[model samples]
Target: MSGITRRSGLLLGGAALLSAAAGAPDRPWAEWDVAVIGAGVTGLSAARNLADHGLRVVVLEARDRIGGQLYTDHGFTSVPVELGAGLIHGAAASTWELVDWAGAETVRVRSEPRAAPGTSVDGAAPPREDESAADYLRRLGVPESDWPPVSDENEPLSRWSAAWMVERGEFDWWSAPRADFRVVGGYDRLLAPLAYGLRIDLGRRVRAVRWSGGGVELVVSGPGGTERVRARRCVATLPIRVLRAADVAFDPPLPAAHRDAIAALDATDAVKLLMEFDRPVLPADADTLAWDGDLDVWSVSRLSPTAPEVVSVWAAGEAARALLALPEDDRFDAGLRALGEAAGQAPPDPVRRTTHDWTRDPHSRGAYLYVPPGAHDAPAALAAPVGGVLFFAGEATTGENTVEGAYDSGYDATDGLLADL
Candidate 1:
């Protein structure tokens, strides 16, 4: 496969599936029909689907908590605020079905335009409308047009850039033909149901997997001693960046082509900062503030629909990288200024605030994966199963690279498992 169109990635990743694990073992080794690594929505969904198919399963999660990025700071507000994977992205039948089963509501939230670098913060700012990010970069002397080639290495970047451009223009990425929705209480609700009964071993970081010939064996360690799992199949629902680090080894090792694809995929480190105001500072009509500053964009979160008092500030690409590099105080100060510039006033002291630094996270290492310019086939290639027993699934494995896409990829992996079974 050469390059996959962004649309293809979205469709390919959205497959449905089922679950199951084989008979139990005697001692030393525990046997399962399938062992799922990572407990995020994709992993949990895959496991749940497998279980539905009468497969016994176990989920091993590195984090002490079950939800990977669907973190909600309950005390932050009366309603839940998502620190990760909050938006539903698209309202697919499967997503809505899961949301309904999980008993969650969808809130309509729109992203304000990202201010171009060097954009004026004065009231005489650019009009609120669709603008090309590439054009903005061209205006700023940023060489965005040259980097992401039309080859395999930079394909995702090219697609992401295209989608990003579409977002800035008179269209929504998923809503051009089909509109999307976000989880009102946050995506945590989406993961809640999937994780209901499955036995998730938290803090159990998988160290290695040996899946060359016989059944797959995974070496996982935690506060307790190292435990090994032998299963008929293993679905690795971890981010590709984690796999690239080789933090977890493979017995026969990933195939050279898979290794190349893994190496080719890029993690666009991103950050989202939450800034509370003494009161709502944005005008009723103004949902976003794009400024020429260290921060890229700021928007009113309306986290709790009724309150509309608090808002979230977000940064991406180089802008997010700059914030991540800042000292704690400087980072907060720069964020405040960006908020002030966008709201047209200095933001009041925050009662509560925090930043989600995806760059610093060990497991994720970054937010989502973006195929550079020319390297589009990597996602599909990454999705290709290894040794039949070793399967891969995650935001990086799918074309959509969104919450819905993640779930779809999980289901698709389960489908693959069922096919081989």
Candidate 2:
């Protein structure tokens, strides 16, 4: 297929069965059994399920790509590199189902180092009662010199409650330490199959959704011009940040409860910087190196045993914001400097550098959603359907903030829609 055309939009594999209702360009509105907004994993999952049930499903995406945050760039290195989500957090994660179906190869990542509960960073005494992780670090006499310059603005680990710290420590030691896995091919390989046999129109930015009556109407703008689509029910899988930003107007507006939930949910700021080197700077066995400096954390792994040397540096929260504020070249230089410092030598000259700042990306204003201290119920509220006309599904709605969560939320939204019908 060439691409989505204005005259006749690109259709999924089985779209021919619904052509009578969808292919009429002269019609005022393109009709469908269901219209899905956003071509991310959630939307695609919903579309696939609905299409399998004989529903005429049309998925509209604002971006040219389909994966959304599941982006994997094969051209970045000799081996595929993920610019968005890279890890399958657990064996039972729904992502693994897709991986199996796609026959994609996966490699388990080395376990992360763990700190025992009440353990001191500098071999000092145990933490005091109710001491936060940051406070514990300080009590251990861990030098402030170890942290990045933006550490002052960053939320101190010490702010975390004791219960939260204990849970994190246990999870790090038992669950997350060595259970992570990466798709040898790229996340796209696993996700792309979900769009099969569905109509997916790329570059269709939904500008407005007017659902005042028995059905919903969508005003979509694309490269060619504006078009309106109508459907009995609509599934909106837009990211939390996008919804919070009111990027797409909703007619009659969302209910106060939904609005409140949207307002309560927070999207985290994050940046991933990928650099390729002419030679290894760190030990070949080194899989991860965490810095107390501006870089925050750097995960070093060869894309493949023999692939080009690459390292992925990640920063979140305020550190990410600070990093993003610098010019691109400056950020690259900072990453190089941090890597060199960690390697205890001047790092080899990097052959290439790339980064994706989720905070600045229009489609995804932030990395993922999180609930504030008192807004634990926000995800449930956000996931609730509005009068059966609008359905919500995303990582935020699922409260999991993982690819598997997004996929499952899509199914949950579809199930809700079917039950209503």
Candidate 3:
């Protein structure tokens, strides 16, 4: 009880198990079977799957709202705005099931993938065992004009592992781009079914995790105060930056494998700049465009023909850092200038503009992890369970750097956890 005083706390926000900080250990939390940290799609999917198997699962989330990096901005414009992950990357993406369940409207993004479907990397030879995406593009003889879209999307693709791309089925972007889509109702609607009947504790920021073969303990702090929660097993779906920042400590230290994997991945400086245009900016048939600069401009109307003429400009790496460093008043101008430059004309000023710098947000350290070349196996190593007590699931755990990848990781971790037990 002596050490418990300094860290004494009670579970906060929605989970009704623990009653008081001092007496929480002896309370109803003892009945909890699993503790899932971070209520993003990864945690939600795991919790949902566990509950379906008749397990008592409690989800602890740091933010007041759900969706870690998959936030939808309803107030940004008359139509839903995606500040985070926006597209379903492939026809085989697992998110389509959730989309159907949510009944969300979606439209195919206009793209001529590799000139036709079922081709092999635009008909070029397969990437070598140790090839980078940048090299692959060069090998394909992709025109410099066409490289902007791919280059701007993944700045410094010299770090993108070609094998990792094949594993993620992302080579299809050039091999098959017609399958991408945007959710008109927003990606958040898929949460309803994933979260049904789950006891999610929002605002519970887990600061430390202490686990052993006996069970696992988590020290979480929230608005009310701090508290400890115990469960037979735990799943941590924290973002790569959060773990790398050591925001949450692990008792006895994590193994060298996890530590090395942690160092292998890093967060990209990513930002989304949304501006409302009086009229369309890109060509009528164009679904997306890469400006001369590092920004990729696309009309929101592609999500729905009736959607407003708002165009969202996306930038990553150096461009995002530049945009984030700009003064509040100058950022929008930079986006407008990029669009105007790419479209070859300066149009009327945007009626309104909105931009969110997730890089600067404390709750979310950054957007997500990007796998550097030669470290393609980092996600698998990071996800490897520790002492049969701690499991990790996030966008980083999956080879992909997208929401669907995150969603797949959630259930994948759940399947692994079930097998472990």
Best by TM-score: 3
> Could you say which candidate leads in lDDT?
3
Q: By TM-score, is 2 or 3 better?
A: 3
- Greater-TM-score candidate between 1 and 2: 2
Model 3, span 24-137: residue lDDT tens: 222245457899998998888888777666678899998888888888889977888888888877677777767655556777777544233333454456677567777776
**Candidate order by lDDT, highest to lowest?**
3, 2, 1
lDDT of 1 at 275: 62
lDDT of 1 at 399: 47
lDDT, candidate 1, 144-200, per-residue tens: 433222121112222343323332331123213333355666667667556665667
As a whole number from 0 to 100, the lDDT of residue 240 in candidate 1 is 69
Q: After superposition, how far is residue 282 of candidate 3 from its true place, in Å?
A: 4.5
TM-score for every candidate vs. truth?
A: 0.77, 0.80, 0.84
- In order, the Cα lDDT scores of the candidates are 0.64, 0.71, 0.75
RMSD list, candidates in order: 9.2, 8.2, 8.9
Evaluate model 1: give its TM-score.
0.77
